[model samples]
Target: MGDDHWLDLDTSKYPFPNTLWHIKPPKEIAIKVTVMLIVGIIGIILNSIILHILIKNRWLWSPSNYLIGNLALVDLITLLLCPWFMLVRDFYQQYVLKHFGCYFEGFLQASLLLTSVGAVMLVSYDRLAAAGLTPDARVTKSAAIKLIVITWIASMLLSLPWITHREYVERQWADYLETFCAEDPKVLGIYWHFTLFILVWIPLGLMVVTYGAIMWRLEWSAKKLSSKGAGMAVSKAKTSAMRIAACVLITAVICRIPYTVLIYWRNRLSNEVNSVEGSFDAMWFAANYLIYMNCAVNPLIYGFTNRRFRKAMDRTPGIAWCKFGSWCCVYPVYKRKRILEVDKNTEKVFVIEGTPRPNRKLAHVIKNILHINKETLDFSVKIDEVTTKPTKITPLKI
Candidate 1:
């Protein structure tokens, strides 16, 4: 299109008011900044505790845990750095004019952003493996550690270009500073294709396929176990996995889908599109941030849906009060012995108290199958006599 024709074309095609910069007044900006700061701090603290549990509890180290740890580290960095942007957006909307502020904001934004994309990709694969596991399957610790390293490295490399190419320019009509994050035609063309394939489409697409298979498998198990008198455990697992898979699907749709579509269009219409005059930046920020928040939200899914994470979070004091819905009521289990005397018609039976729900169910099933129900009683009646005879029982007060 010629310049005259382009000028004649209505600019309203670019919809929505552009209020991303100085949209809110100073006071409002402060409030926004403060809220973001507080949330970021809490996220960092909670993610740190998650990392600690995954590390200290050797038994919990698995491929899924490694993905979660990498995500937490990404969130930690984002939270730590976002407050500076919050301050600038609040107190110094025009601070992009300052060279230091410009580079800092641009670099951190790119880091948090590209890292987030990579982290989500890793999480998608991790969840795929985790969800694909057989009822008794688990991803090994060595594999998990290796994947975690790969996730960090991939994310770092993806974000490196932004750090290297970011520069500041002047825009006469707009704010004094124009922060142009490097969008090199050739380089970005390659990156767009590469990221779209590996990070955007492949990982998310695999998640959809993997989770579908997992749900199908879990549903099949539930159906099979229904007639086997397996109680609620199988059903509960199936239900939990289904919900988590749904959440992941929703997250991918809301976060990745739009960006992917926009990027495809942007690539096709490269020079044809001069500038984004609409609410693109705002929507982009919202979508991207929501995706980044998924890292924090995963811990919540674990806390609510996965019993082990809930128990660990309860014991982890620093993160217990974050109100991310990961809190649980936990009673400390202790080992103890009781002195007892046995009599005829009574057998030796031990009750393992304070066991988790899954273990409790399994233990009860095993005990019932073995026909061993005794409270420190003597087996003097007869050989293989499965009889329930209650004798005098007194509580030993603690």
Candidate 2:
């Protein structure tokens, strides 16, 4: 097993005096690898949790949520494919992955980046439509699915250049053969500029426009309402929506702007300086860290800002186990039971739990059984006993 002559390659082509194959990773490279590994692990876990929550909960299956789920999926794929390869390339002097890995990594990164940007734009537009239009005019589930398919297709088409231009090359040093993957420098300059425009500027522009319009429309609707109560409700809703949108948009810009600037700087420098080293620099590390950090931060943003998502996460069995221990793993049997309560004055019917008690106040009965707020329940009400099975009760007119 130890007699492996295949490993003993000729070193005559190497430029260096020493012929040692092993090279110790530099401090900067080690730090970059560590940070990237940490971020990738965090991103993978967070994205998986987001996808799990979205998939497991039937109530969260809305058109908007579908797009959000797609974004999470994209980020998850990006973290899985891009970062590890980048870390490997940074740590190793010679590219271990050959031509296939080069093309695959390049294509995957380009396509996913575009898909993520497109998804974010679509989400912003979906929010705009929901805020400004009637329920009938908002995007439907079918429409959102079609949009997602189109985004992926478009991203693939846009990323075709990566497949065409990327190449695996080997150069000889004094005592080592250096291998690396790179794109056609001529094509990279033009292609990357176009990608930057699509990935950063366009999405940023759309987010601002869509979210701004939503806020304006909300404010206008609030102003048109005559009742102060209605106005306050609208104001409250606007504030909540704005808060979520602001956090998402702000984080996106902060994460992407540095990477965009780094690319721009590199492209400009490449034009002037005949050659640039493939080794990672401070700017490269920082830019990459921010971009990958975005993936981990997205789940945090949603979990923190969106009350519904937080509530859903709380109800998730896995999360429940974490919070409440192993006892939460026991599934409770739910029996179909409902009580019909009719308000005497307003004639409004409500579905309550448990058996009706004769001569007892409706609010008191509901408070004891369902633990519902008494203030929301009508004091003057009549209860009608219904069968303890899944059945609808029509409201009786008094």
Candidate 3:
């Protein structure tokens, strides 16, 4: 809101006019809203598909799979919460500020924020135990389920203040702005500690320690490779290890590190220190948004870097229905419904129909006949404008 004094951080007046709820231009606001909407839609769809796939393949219910699934679900919540953000940012720009909107936006933001932290920490542990310390150390399905449940509970508890403090307040200044879903400074201070402790500090420490240990073990293993007469095997193993390490490192550096630094810096600085409405605050806000983008980035990274994930994605029926974007891919979940995708550039639409029941013997016979991997046989139908629905045809069988 344009009520500069409303923010708990500082009392300094923002040189920007208070007549309008937001200082930004309408065009800029529109652009930001559009981008957030696009990203949110894509994120939800992709993560949904991934979750469905994991469900379809029971293997996806494994401990690692459960963690990934929870991550996707958290991302889904974050995406669903974007519209509130889009609305407030737009409303603020238009000089229309409502108490309810503020609370909604702030509450959703906190919920998603906490959930994201929990999800990432869960993922870090999953990777550490599953891939780093002992590749053979598999988490039981029940344990994984318990972990996800606990993550959700923690997220809910941590976000309670935001929900509790949603209210309409008038600043001493002539400006009357609604403060939706945000706690008072004192309450928020408590929350800040919890969030920083769980989300920032703990995860950073675990990632550094676990990844470091893994790298050390990998280096030691590489040394043994030469003496074991498995030079080529060792080289390949090392390469795989390096790739995983690189992925973790990049994710940590580009996503988590900056946000953590910013939080610490903001806390340490006096209210007046960073209260000026200038390029710095704008940059800081942009940086905060960029950190949020990390949630959407996970699937893209998984699709590109993980060969098996890519191959599986390609085989998914109705993938063509997803819009193709420069930075992201969109796809439909072919679970209970059979759908055909029609995509051209950024525009994508889907037509749904009844999915065929899997005939085990028939599927095996067809796979053998077609000389293709049975796992790749994701049965689907095609739809065209005139069809109004899916038009099923016998798939090619060897």
lDDT tens digits by residue: candidate 3, 1-398: 12344466433344333344345667877877777767677777778777766655553345666777778877777777755565555344332446665555666666776777777777667656754565557567787788788877877777777657655554333343323333466677566677667766676677677677666766676787878765665576567666766776686567666666666555655555325345545555555566566777766554334433444445555652442232132222342133233322334233223434446797766755463332223323222112344243243422
Model 3's TM-score against the true structure = 0.66
TM-score for each predicted model, relative to the true structure: 0.62, 0.73, 0.66
lDDT score of residue 158 within candidate 2:
92
Number of residue pairs clashing in candidate 2, backbone atoms closer than 3 angstroms, sequence gap of 3 or more or interchain:
8
- lDDT per residue (tens digit) for residues 1-398 in model 1: 01224334444444422344444466756765665655666667667777766666665565666767777777777767765564554343333435555456655665565666566666665565555565445556686677667766666666666555544533332333223223455565576677666646775777778788888877787788888777367787777688778887786676567767666655554333424423554444454455455555655543344455555555555555663333232221211112122333455354434333544587777865444334334333433234567533333433
TM-score of 2: 0.73
lDDT of each: 0.57, 0.71, 0.58
C-alpha RMSD of each candidate structure in angstroms: 11.9, 9.9, 13.1
Among all candidates shown, the one with the greatest lDDT: 2
Residue pairs with backbone overlap in model 2: 14-173, 14-174, 14-175, 15-173, 15-174, 15-175, 16-174, 16-175
Ranking by lDDT: 2, 3, 1
Candidate 1 stretches with Cα past 4 Å from truth are 1-24, 31-35, 55-59, 82-138, 169-182, 189-199, 227-232, 261-278, 302-304, 317-398
Question: Lowest summed lDDT over 10 consecutive residues: which window, candidate 3?
Answer: 378-387
Q: In model 2, which regions exceed 4 Å deviation? A: 1-30, 226-229, 270-280, 323-398
**Where in model 3 is the C-alpha error above 4 Å?**
1-23, 34-38, 83-99, 102-104, 132-137, 171-183, 261-276, 302-304, 320-398
